[model samples]
Target: MTFTGGNPQEEPPRRVAKKSKKRFLWLALVTLLALIAVVLSVLYDRGEFDGLRRRLLYTKAQKDENGCAQLYRYASDQSGSFASLDGSLVSVSMHQVSVLDETGKTVYEQTVKFQSPALVRGAFRAAAYDVGGTSVYVLTAKGLACQVDTSGEILAVALNKDGYLTVTSNESGCKAAVRVYDASGQPVFAYRSADRFIMTAALSDDSRTLAAVTMGQSSGVFTSYVVFYRINSESALTTTALTGSLIYDLIPMGSRFCAVMEEQLCFLDDSGEVRAAYSCGSDYLRRVDCGDGYAALLLGRYRNGTQHRLVTVDSDGQVMASLDVDGEVLSMSAAGRYIAVLFSDRMVIYDKTLAECARLDAVSEARQVLMRADGSAVLAGSTAASLYLP
Candidate 1:
């Protein structure tokens, strides 16, 4: 009768109030921390801790004294699917193809608007190479190759020199062929194989040797054979098999060759003879460039990992130097005195001594790095491409 029990409703109200207060206090503390973070970020952006932040950012650009390298923003009008740099010129292709000079000015622009033959109705692939700084070799689909000047005019279609156009298509099961034409588009030599497929082909620098990878099949197993041939004429040549079992990459290293086959790094001579073979111990070899009497092999792990290794080897299969790198080495190009390595986020330029010359954040997703004959570097990225001059 005399209120032996407390007021239940009043006690419930006090408990609810205490919980609300605790939540409010927690939220207030979080808001204060966020405010402090914003303030710190603003200060950092305003150069309050610029030096410290730069160290953490690993910006080697500021340390470059000779300014032998620079970073430039390379934006393409279209999404770039392929990029190549030769000398101070950068070539990019996506919906169309264009060439940009060292000053970021368009030297040539051409829309790839050619219709393929009915027999070769597939997506076309293109590659551009600088012939002499004035002319470019444009290799396109259906064996349509052309040489264009810097002004975007066709100089020669279906080049007929000693080294002309050769195309290999897998349209027919394991049927491979090579068609050579003269500068006037006249067919000089044509060879077709009924047994195997020709995957790819490359000509030597001297234009006397022709290297190709041939695909062979037996009992559902796939194998590749590299054939080195003496290019006597477009029509008359002899090919000798070098190696078998899936040739992944073939690069002509001056008088010799370097290739990756089934995770093995192998070197071959001009006569299709194996010089040396070494286990790469990785899934794939990304790129190989020859310079300073050595080949720089960029090897990468297959899965998501940051471990990358750059190995330098002499022409005779001697290991010169090896360096562990941080990111995936995307592409590499070398010239007389420098080598430019393109990583995912950065571009490193090194001298013949393997000393770091300059490090720069890539303007975009770098797809290719080219060290020009003039000691400059060109970078081709996703959205843009740039040239770095010394």
Candidate 2:
């Protein structure tokens, strides 16, 4: 009442206050919009907006009887060792690894040798297979592992399959013992572990990083700890522990995610943190693989009972899809756009969505199914092995 004219200073203060509130409101709105943008980006990156396509089906032709008969008759032939088998080329070994086209014509052949005597011994015990590419990995006895190229040269040699190797050409000058090699057989980077023995070792599809399990060894027992390492451009290394358990299997889900099986199924991040754990109902889990953002768990009973269950989950431990089968899944493989599920007498092909797309009656029990990156499959059993083209 006393200041009827309204003080000029008071007016200025009021104006400043109003302007400040307005500015804050605008800032808050911008922040909210930025948060929404980030969320949308994440969802898009996770493939949440992708549309589902219809599951396609294909008729099964009796596995080319002539081809099967040829492979069967040649299984024991010393001249028939596999150099490569995928797509249009099937390479067998006689004097050297021989490359052949689908029509049984020679394409390429080369002479390669094992690096170390230990490696050579391991090579003989290895189950060698080709990925339809220039690289080949040998899973050896004593758990020694190595990869070679088309030239049949040793690229990288791991003392044990659990990711320890010697890096040849890094800045560290082979001082860094835990190293990984590229497809060209060059030691690009190195890693270090806390434990001397590794229980499991899994290489990513890109081969940039390796997931491994180190174990504390006793007289006869071992306690396992899982870890991962990144191979960087500087040839330097960084490692992180993922979990502690008696790991039975480790499967990489891209470079950042991995499925680790101990007593329970656990999903781990690149840093080895457990993102999720699933209590596998069965006592024995034979194999596990992931694709299309889903994991396929193969469980078996001692009496030959088997089941195939597919679980799709996100990084947050949320289940997106679950598929179950009544029959025993004898063997399985996944690559590219398909998952090949091998049962006792039938071969079922499912898309990434876990929906059955194709079925074929097999001649005998399926022991192993090898899914190639090129969309072909090789089904090997106790009695027979046949290749399938999709």
Candidate 3:
């Protein structure tokens, strides 16, 4: 009765209650949102979520835990030759080499009117060389630049991080010559061989030592040799003979050399002495790749056996792991401690001990694959290129 508007006191209580309810709801909502955010962060750390929101919510593509944020569809059905240098993708097609970054954006592109097959690698930023020809081109911010082409056809080439290069060339049927060059296109050293075919070579980090694997006829029979040279002195350091095998590739690991042979994996020191060796019995070694202080060998069966195997080896020539799969390996790549092997219909990624980290299903047959240091892979299929992040 004392109120002027029938119940001024009652109106204050009702208004107070309503305001209290609104405040409670606001506090509860904030608490719930914060709790949800914390739970999601924990799950992501445990890989339970693998940051799926990054792929689903973000506008720009980013690599998720599944390692899939990039893809490319080739204009042609042909599979291409490629290599990784500086995390850039250098792919070779019919008459062109395309360089792309991790985002699938084409950074640089080059065409060859000469119509010869090409090879590309990430060395000195990026480089592309003609396979089975004499032309070698290195690309930089300036443009497509050619290395000093010497006499004879260029058979093999290797480049270091500092742009130091090693080229193997043959003159007719006589012999092969191995030469090392600095970044300025000046020859560091040249080693000549008579009656020996220099198949391939590798340069060390300091560009001090050059390793070459050559094959020659000894007593009317084929014999392979692992040779080392001191680039500064232009003098031969060591030459070791290998029997009953053919050397296919030479790779540098730290201060040692890994010689990939047909039936064996041999390690040689800087002096070219065989430090360790692993034999494959009758199995034929298909390919050997070194990364993350390890070497991986792709082995085929003996005398037309069906199943194939992959052997993970350490720098000390220790057999760390072996995985046998039932198909021909279409392509393989290794980075850091990860090894990626692609079959016709699927791909498998393994760690240093050859444990299965991930198995990616493929829609079509993959022709080749490129792996990254973070256990991600890019599989080049006939129709498209798929990036697998894990």
Candidate 4:
């Protein structure tokens, strides 16, 4: 016939070639899908997805003429009762703790009887506790993560970026005690001091090191000691004594710790030794806040009608920037690389170099400012809170 010229072996070779081409196409598609998966994983780890989701879900805050958008209006207008945590607003009243999203949606709410309600926020979590009381509630954006009931009164509480909690309490049989809990509310470490009373404690970001401030008197002189400990060890790793200044707070930044004192800001290494200290010269320290790798201090003269000085210091105690602010400063907040200063007549946002990035005038209702790491700010008013995006 007309097809008799074709060989049977030739037909078999053509079939094999088709099969090989199909296999190659399948392999190429699998490789492309694997690459896409890897890219998504990296983006998720860096919080890109979270940021995108927040932008999409919280689009209700429309900018007004002053670039200020009312993100949430509080149910109660109690001053010093609201905080910002992970793009959400946390309000702690005497009877309830509420967590609201950017669109003013209630994410979580609980009834609590706190004599003095206080909030400590981390990267993605916030802890609501009663100052000098026994109730402590650890929370996340989803809901209440855990509740810790200490054996004694809660003196001070610190939260790391990862939500690890360091609680200092006045426990029985000891002058003070420090307890560390993980983000999941599991107990990680505990220490009780009988010689010196622990004022406050901070857990390192890695959760492997714990640093606590202890107040004691040596030779009839008031002294403060920073005690370092390995969470796995029962003994103190190191102790560094600081004198002449009243230690106000202890904040752990990465591998080191920053001790906020009455007269100076001291940066301590992991061994509890002072790496650098920035002394507030003739100015009196009025307010201070610590961010990722820097500290902002508000210093002013004791006289009226004088401008206040705002200083920013790096983790190595190097002065990064200083700005002279005129007017009455109501509150100051630092987070990430930006600092938010709320004055009587206006609000100013400054970068790490103390350069004014944005300013909004006539903010008389704003009592406090909470700066976010994304250059946005939450202005806490007596009755409502608004978001300012620059």
Candidate 5:
């Protein structure tokens, strides 16, 4: 004798319908995100997505001795400092910092001056600290720093795409302190190194963590330590000893940090724990760039022979790609999820997945190289800056 309720017969179908609705909603959400991604990619190629342009034009041409049009009339003699800031070309002059738009229009200009109280230190000479935004920060040769507008006196600065700014200033007694600021330039957190000499530091993308490498010497032996701190808090999160090596650079990649040492390349999480590491036993670490969930290392050994290796790793610290490079690597730039290695006579571009994208032969020998995040590049030779968009 079973008594079935009126709605009991409809229960299974109702549950199935609810599950179908949830599945439909999830599919719709995913589809929307996919569409957005596709749109952004398209815009990125068009150069409109990031205030850039679809076409890249060099400066005006002047007739040279060989009757070849010289492009030097528009470029700069100062190629030591160059950066792409908010789709603009930023070059530093000994007297000022100039920003030029994609079409080659000067948008913003800041001049260095011999102001009071330090007239003997000379005017500001800028080398780009970090670009890729509307405004940049420049560190002068005389230990003076500015926010590239009117802000001043920053000893060091670290910024991420999330608009989190971590700036360090020189404190009393050979110490430095860090201050975390929001996008609007409001102070969100402050940290003092207290007694340690802050060597290299970076701010996590989420702005919730700060990683710094500091060193101390005792008994004529130096030991280095990598410390991680929670933002806006007095307590540190973790301290990891970089034993047996000296860290030369600290790079922040998303949520992790890369401690690039003399012969070791190590990745650490926000907790200061090593997740992945690569040690070049006989080779020397030349350069390391970590961004966009990828880390590219340039290792070379010139003592015994000319041996160079380009190694790329993922965020998980797994080696994604490795290649043997020839000759002296003049510079390496990591942007747009791609890595560009510039030799004197040639330059190669590799995509984020560690696949080769394009290789271009140097025309006049690459004195300086710059690349957009998407693999487009400007190779500045002695005469002109050749733009390559691939």
Candidate 6:
């Protein structure tokens, strides 16, 4: 009678123990899953998966009948500059700078006063500074990377594709000073000139070479020179004498450099010797812009007329393409292998061969056109900016 049920009570206890074990295992599993989720969230917030996310989530923008998608609308200055950086829209105004993501979301905004604000874009970063002021800000797609307060007034600034910055300022003891900074805002190289004025300087794309345009006087005749230097040393690599109108732009194109002057476009090699020079030949240079390995020059027969020709020149100083522009060119931009030209009534996008890729009509509100590496263009208006997809 005492053990009559054949250990039925023992069976109940065994079943209870089995249920408890299963419950514990379920709790442990859930805890592990939660921890994994948290770690993934942190990584996402830190942008550790940005590249993968962008690739996996790539979606074509929904465009309207004008082949345009409104990116962002904000109160902005009419003369502000717009540039594309890492799939974000960077708008530089007189008193503020804003960055908007591809989804038309504001990612960063900073308020600063700038009398003559200018913006230049690299691959993933941008350099915004006052043309004649002391404040310089380096920005990325997320936010401001660094702010550089120079000891003197800022004259010109250049940002390479890798975010290397070159700032030419007016120092007290020298006619002009050129300072090069790495991506972290740390000064890596500095040179002060006492004999000639350094108009502007640019660091090569590889960050190994430096090119400076200097204006000097020889025999009471104004002379300009493209001086090349190694970033790690103080000695000049070579000096290519350029005697003519003032040099307006100096761009580093791989092993060579492209110098844009008032009257001609000169391409120089690493030895600082002119490889090829393209003269305007009766057509006056109206507007000039440099892209990846090519320069876009808008030349006109008359000083300020619609009878202009858009010319694309390669690093070898050869004309890659040319188009007769019959309309007034309001703004033009180049990136990768395409160029975007904004007219008073329309916008035209062309390939490197000057072939028409896409055109958007009735876009008179766009004040500027900024090309993306993917061939899309960002059209900036007075108070809003739109993305044009072809």
Q: Rank the candidates by lDDT, best first.
A: 6, 4, 3, 5, 1, 2
TM-scores, all models, native as reference: 0.61, 0.55, 0.77, 0.84, 0.71, 0.83
Better of 2 and 5 by TM-score: 5
Worst 10 residues of 6 by lDDT: 46-55
Candidate 5 lDDT, tens digit per residue, 1-390? 563555666557767989999999999999999999999899765445533432333224333342222222144444335655444455553455555555555655666431211110001222343221223444332222445331334444566556556665555544766667666556777667867877657777677888877878656777788878888678888888876667776777777887878877788888888988877778777877764678888878565445788888787767788888777677787876678888867788776565677777733455666666645666655434445654
Off by over 4 Å in 1: 1-78, 81-88, 103-105, 113-165, 170-174, 181-188, 217-222, 233-245, 282-284, 362-367
The per-model lDDT (C-alpha) reads: 0.54, 0.48, 0.72, 0.84, 0.62, 0.84
Model 6 regions lying over 4 Å from their true place: 1-60
lDDT of 2 by residue, 52-122 (tens): 11112112224363223113212332223331233222323322333334343444444443222221101
**160 Cα displacement, candidate 3 (Å):** 3.2
Model 4, 95-173: lDDT tens digits are 8888888777888888777877888877777888898988788887666888888889999998887788889999999
Q: What is candidate 1's lDDT per residue for 1-390, written digit by digit as tens?
A: 554357866557767899999999999999999999998888654434433543443334433443333343444543344433332243443334455543445655665432221111011223443211233344432232565333222211122123344444333332655544433334444455667666665555444666677776656666666666666644424344544467755656666666656566677777777778666774456676666457777776665576777777776777766777787666787765567888778888775556676787733555777665345566665565545544
- Estimate the TM-score for candidate 1: 0.61
> Where is model 3 more than 4 Å wrong at Cα?
1-59, 62-67, 77-79, 113-126, 139-146, 171-174, 219-221, 363-365
lDDT of 3: 0.72
Off by over 4 Å in 5: 1-79, 113-155, 217-221, 304-306, 381-384
Worst 10 residues of 2 by lDDT: 49-58
| Weakest lDDT window of 10 consecutive positions for candidate 1 | 114-123
